[model samples]
Target: MTDKTTSPPPSEEPAGELLLTSPPTFLGSVEGATVEAIAALAREGSVPTILQVPTKGLGPDLPDNVPILWDRHAQKPISLLEEVRAAKPPLERVGTAVVTTLASFIELTNRHKDDGSAIFAKTAWPEPKLTAVIDYHMPGETKTARRGKHRIAYPFPLTDEFKVWVAGHGKTFKQADFAEFMEEHAAELAAPDQYEINTFEPMFKERFGTPAEILDLSRHLEVNVGAKMKSAVRNASGERQMVFETEHTGANGQPIDIPGIFIVSVAPFLAGDAEPEVVRIPARLRYRAAGGEVVWFYQLYRWEFFLRERVQDDLARAAKETSLPAFEGAPEMAA
Candidate 1:
């Protein structure tokens, strides 16, 4: 197979042969083609930069091939169908970051919204400031998701304006408040007396389903409590856990945080004098022996309430900074 970059030497061929030399392709006529290949095709066809996402027939039933669903273009892009770019604003996000730090986010926001002389605007030419639609993940899930890694996207207010709002109305443009905010959150998180898990109550373990979340300890489970390693081990060679279920209480009370970051975005920036996120919630380790396998239990203090209150507080702050009315209710996310 010939690569896109290294094409075969030019050679004259018959008209019939020339037709087969390069098959005509629109934007996405070639599947799994590289961006360079798509760009080459677009240039050859004079495709417009603007594009549109498709919709489905009215109210298609389940299992039906519905175009209205966004997943149809989840992996493949909309413009590849024929154009180099979307004809107008797209409802879809440009991309996602599997791992994003808080600092990287802040830096990107400042560059675009505050100072874009070098990175975003290189030509010294006039152009609308760029805004990216993206989804990003951070360690530790909050109450709503009930899962590790906060998948931030819509309703989380991951916008340039929102970033500025989070930074306290662009006060310093350094996102100076983020570290303080995170530290306070961490302190509160470390001690969540707010959680009310009364296992002693008979109603807890009734005829109903088991309320506790059960997880099997495995290599995939990575635990980080703080700057230093906090671990308790009974037997290294043991199958899963130590001799007793609750013997190894490594870093139970101690709470470590993620790297000190200001914010994260596509553009590179300095770390500045930031500290690791004060992701304060402390964790508890408990285990049970079941069928010769150990089931480990880890819980975050005041998790659900914490996540909700944190977001709400952020909203209130943004409102105060922007001099706008705070949104009273939770924002709905559409599938």
Candidate 2:
């Protein structure tokens, strides 16, 4: 009858197939990991790439096989993006290159006991020398909007002391804000006197103190003039909150029994023979409890340094000599 062999309707392409067309080669297992991976890719070649990573708070660490973590938990993505974007053009212009990895950064930060906080107490360490000045702009929030101010400025001051430490040991300027904050409030932090008793002592006494045993308990606990003090108060609802800080070092040599908080700050400055100024880096390390160990994790933040031409030249020279084969030539080509 009818020679109607109608062709079947054309099938739509599958979404997975469409994605495979590009085939994302440069991928990470976390969100901000893109920055470091992209930077690495740029150093290798100006190849376009895409990265994928686990969403925030999904895990404590980067997923297995992921090349980089980007330390998004320590710093926000927008900020990191801004830094990379701002640094890109200058680095390219000067023929310089850089590669950052989460594993390298973590290793750098973990090299010292107490994360180099001990250096501050050494007194022999030279005072921080001004290098480049880094300017930080706080993110806009509802509270800032209400105040008609959207940003707060931060300054990072770097010193030769820190540079030496970084050169010999791969230390990072994480928690710089805590260090800066503490320096700002140094005058306010004073050790308690012998006559003064901390707020916790009353609780200790009420739970375990007799009038005759009070002095013995205090002595047994090693309470003395230089001891730090702290207090916690319970509201009518029986909820407890810490009121203030004093001074005390935990088993890990962290400021556990201290009364006040320590905050770090950062700024940019010039260093080495490089005439052009660079970003100043500062950091602070504080002790916190984690996994039954008194470990220290830093809340690293940085200030912006407008990437300059000369600085880029210096970086390029350095990159040419380092592991960045793309800057010089591919390994096979060089061979």
Candidate 3:
């Protein structure tokens, strides 16, 4: 016969683990006394893990030893809790002493205050969700202590107002088309504007700065005209515009998605019929959010004014079937 041993009910089993959930922003605050309490508990041989929910930017800096995880929206909700519980010894349930700091979540939801006030509870499942607040810190003091605290400024979302402003800036000419335009009108623009820098170019430099770097692709040894670009919008400001989407990966390898629209503006120079019908065509990058639904983030490169000499040289070289000179200074990959 099998041994007749009685098993204790689940509630009377060995102690379970503690799990804390909070917005990443709250984790860094000086007012995170509750988190500090959890950290202390964790240091004292208690197994308390933190689950950080994503926000607009980088999360708070945390200790190296704390076992922290992410609550990715892509994954199943509370899956981390289930995972920890499943990995525990016989009678322990994960999230037995779960605490949540809902302040960040609340602000994100309501778009308001940034106080570190939170909701604390013993969050075991199959039991009443409410429990005693571990930190007896009062709200009024927290509010008073945090008066006029400004949060770190985050990137503004694209709005309809910004889109209207971008639309009013007139047509965007594609880089390739503008290059070809420069090439086609090379003879007309070559001599007069050859060495002359536009007075407004200095202002442009002050505003946008020099190019981050340039990719040198002159070595392949072929002469070609800039291609006609595909248009996203037909005629936003009376001229066909080309919109290009690209991604920027920072030094840390994080990818930033961006959509840049190129607008080419031409101002006539009164060189008269005797001289070349010289015109100053400024090619600019109109950068909006990746999806093209938001406000303009920035005006990136001052393409025409900066690259005028290079463009003219390349066009002249292509016309004569001469190999273009290789770019110097930095390696191509530096860009």
lDDT of 1 by residue, 1-335 (tens): 87578788777674555354677778846465587887887675553233344444546564434232122323333424445355555454333232143344334433322111111111111111111221222224344331111122213323342232223322321111222333332312222222322331232331111111111122212233223323332222332222222232333443322211111111111223544322222233333343333334333333334335444443343334323232342223221
- TM-score for each candidate, following the candidate numbering: 0.24, 0.16, 0.17
Q: Which residue runs does candidate 2 get wrong by more than 4 Å?
A: 1-158, 164-181, 184-276, 280-313, 316-335
Error of 3 at 212 (Å): 16
Which pairs of residues collide in candidate 3?
158-294, 158-295, 172-262, 172-263
What is the clash tally of candidate 2? 41
Question: Top TM-score: which candidate number?
Answer: 1
Candidate 2 structure quality by residue, lDDT tens digits, 1-335: 87888899887875555444574656644556778887787665533233455466666775644333243333422224666687786421111111132222123223311211111011111221111101111234334211111111111224443343234222322222223323343433233232223432342331212222322211222111132322221222332222222344332334423322112221123333334343322222234432322222322222122212323333344333332211211111110
> Candidate 1: which stretches are off by over 4 Å?
1-279, 282-284, 330-335
For all predictions, the C-alpha RMSD in Å is 33.6, 34.0, 35.1
Candidate with better TM-score, 1 vs 2: 1
Report the Cα lDDT for residue 144, model 2: 29
What lDDT tens digits, residue by residue, belong to model 3 across residues 159-215? 232233234344443433333333343332211132223443454442212221100
Q: Which ten residues in a row have the lowest lDDT in candidate 2?
A: 115-124
